[model samples]
Target: MQPIGWVLLILAIILIIIIIKNFQIVPQSHAYVIERLGAYKTTWSTGLHLKIPFIERIAKRVSLKEQVVDFPPQPVITRDNVTMQIDTVVYFYITDPKLYAYGVENPIAAIENLTATTLRNIIGDLELDNTLTSRDVINTKIQVILDEATDAWGIKVKRVELKNILPPREIQAAMEKQMKAERERRAKILDAEGDKRSQILVSEGLKESAILKADAIKESKIREAQGEAEAIMTVQKAYADSLKMLNEASPTDKVIALKSLEAFEKAADGRATKIIIPSEIQSMATLAATLKEMVSDKNIDISPKSEQQAQTTETNS
Candidate 1:
């Protein structure tokens, strides 16, 4: 081969090598920023792409996937003049590769600084108590502001989270003390309610017991009175039955007179102040007195000597 042909063959081989090397394959969820002669040209998406060896260059390779950045704690002052340290996390993704390549010198650092600034501004409007409790509000406000501000830089802010908020040690101690006191107060109220309920239960039990006792006593007295009344009724019924049987017998006059005499005798035996004799038994009483006189005279006996004299006189006559 001639020397000139050899040089031209070597040049062609080098050009083929350069062209092969310049062929780019953009992967998924990635973008390539192309610069033509040190000027922004176009962005390359996920595909096979070609670039001029000397005129076109890849300025930047930006990831289109979601990304997260955790910023360091930054000092912030609340509306109550309370100082605190707050850290944050930002979720973002590149929306425009061209802007991302040329918009900012350091995108991560710019985002961090922007996050810190927005956080301070938002926190400065809230008091310490609101700052501690309004995490979602703060996150939303920061996200909205960051999304708007970072739109020019090709960063789409998806979410902003307040990772941590640290207050002064003395303020933390005071909060803990206040929480403990509140818990204790609630516990005391519960105890008082429980005690009140117990006392009410005890009083109700006593009241029920007293009522039962009174009812029992009333029932016992009622039973005793009923028994007494039944006994009296039984005795009266027996007496009435006896009187009815006597009336049904149909006694003769003599038997009736004798029964009257017996009743009069029973009345005489008692310690009565006065006794009234019936006219029908008066004759019977007189006869009974005469018989009693004769019996008394006959019971007398003569002496032995008087009896012998009486017998001698009778023989002489």
Candidate 2:
């Protein structure tokens, strides 16, 4: 190769290197802080940017997206002098790349220190119980303070959270025991309430059964009384019908006397110590005995004798 050709090739390679170094493509959600002549120049956003190769350079690449930082546990004392270890997580984003590059030497380290200091200040005013319970209050206070303080550094604190608050080992064990006891008590109370409800349901069912049974018994008694009354009415109606039939017959006196005799015969069949006979029945019985004697004698005339006895009975009456 010729020397002139070699020199031309080296110049072409140097030019390519300068072009590659000077031109930059900033990615999305990122900003490049540029410094020219050892001073802040401008911030390059998400686009192609050109800079003088040696005079202007990227000082820092600041992410514009929201970011998370998990700080280590910081030991703090409560108002009651109880020492605890608490860790924090911060959500932040850069608002200005120039300020982020020139505002502070180390923005993350400054934020960590600020978080620890603010946590101590808030926890120191509360007792052990309050410090354990009031995590939200502490988080809000820390977030407000950090946001105000980091504004100069082009950082906006979106939120602060206490990742963990670990108390002493003995206190943790005691809290676990208390929680277990409370759970057991709730279980017992629930069981007792269930038993009470079951008993009440059982008693109500029994009471309803008893009432139904009583109602059935009452209905049965009413049915029995109705049956007895119906039987009595039937018997009385039968007696009334018999009397009406007898009255409609319009019997003669002889037929009436025969009927009376049949009644007397029926009464005589019973085991009565004494029986009273009416005077009319006695006269009829005497007349029947006389007629029977005359018929057996064969010498007495029945028609004339019967006429003479009837005349005598009528005159005597």
Candidate 3:
């Protein structure tokens, strides 16, 4: 109702509002950057925090939590002059709130644009095949470069990744065809190699088998020759023994004649069923002539003693 009381009431209301605004409750994994008169001042962390209300204002509030930023695809030309579209993602966190707010204007946009430029530059220096295969190496290089660049902005680049790499349709088809042909060529080479090895082994085995067969034949021929030699030696020894026995003995003519007659009788024993011989048959003219010629010498005798033997036998009977 009074003017003084009204002024006091307005001041109390202003003071309460200031107090409420001064005390800031930041959530976990978050930070606030306080600026005094539009200049770098201090940093606030999670939980209950206080700031100079009238003199200092929160210039920028940044999350200390890890964050992911997916950058838009950028077109890059490889060393082979092939154009490709590549997309990337980056993981970062605000380590120093004061520096994050004051060190750079629009820190997130700066990071994204810098990442796109660096990726394009790096990939441009490589061939299409290298780009597709060496993604990890590229990612690490990009992360290191970005980490160094963004260090002043208080942004810790945790990782850099190439989300997708899309070559032209013709390039994709060409790569597929090349891969298929490579696999087929390798398969054919392996098959040929296996066949060559198999043939070599088979040839070696056949060669060894032929050698063994030849050795067997040689051994058999040697044994046969040895046996034949032994048989010939035996035959020669028998002939020599028989000749020696014949040369060692000499008999009278009568005894030789009697032995020949006995040999004739023994030879005819199994010839026919029956035979008839007259007494004194040995004195026949043909037999007498043959014996007289063989014993023409003075010391030989050709008398027919066989006829006298027969006559004696008859008288006794």
TM-score winner:
2
Tens-place lDDT per residue, model 1, 212-275, is 9999999999999999999999999998998688789877776776666566456444544333
> How high is the CA lDDT of each candidate model?
0.83, 0.84, 0.79
User: Per-residue alpha-carbon lDDT of model 2 for 1-317, expressed as tens digits?
Assistant: 99999999999999899988899999999999889999988888999999997899898998999999999999999999889999999999999888888899999999999999999999999999998788899899999999999999999999999999999999999989999999999999999999999999999999999999999999999999999999999999998998788889988888777776566446444544333444454457664674445334433222223432332111110
State the lDDT of candidate 3 residue by residue for 1-317, as single tens digits: 99999999999999999898788898888888788888877777778977877789888778888999998898989999999999999999988887887788889899989998898889889998899999999999999999999999988999998999999999999989999999999999999999999999999999999999999999999999999999999999998997577557776656555666555345344433222333454555664455345334212432333544531111110
RMSD of candidates 1 onward, in order: 14.9, 9.4, 14.0
Which portions of model 3 miss their true places by more than 4 Å?
A: 1-3, 178-317
Candidate 3 all-Cα RMSD: 14.0
Lowest summed lDDT over 10 consecutive residues: which window, candidate 1? 308-317
- What TM-score does each of the candidates earn? 0.58, 0.67, 0.55
| TM-score, ranked from best to worst | 2, 1, 3
CA lDDT of 104 in candidate 1? 90
Q: In candidate 3, which residue pairs get closer than 3 Å at backbone N, Cα or C atoms, i.e. clash?
A: none
Give the residue spans of candidate 1 off by over 4 A: 180-317
Comparing 2 and 3 by lDDT, which wins?
2
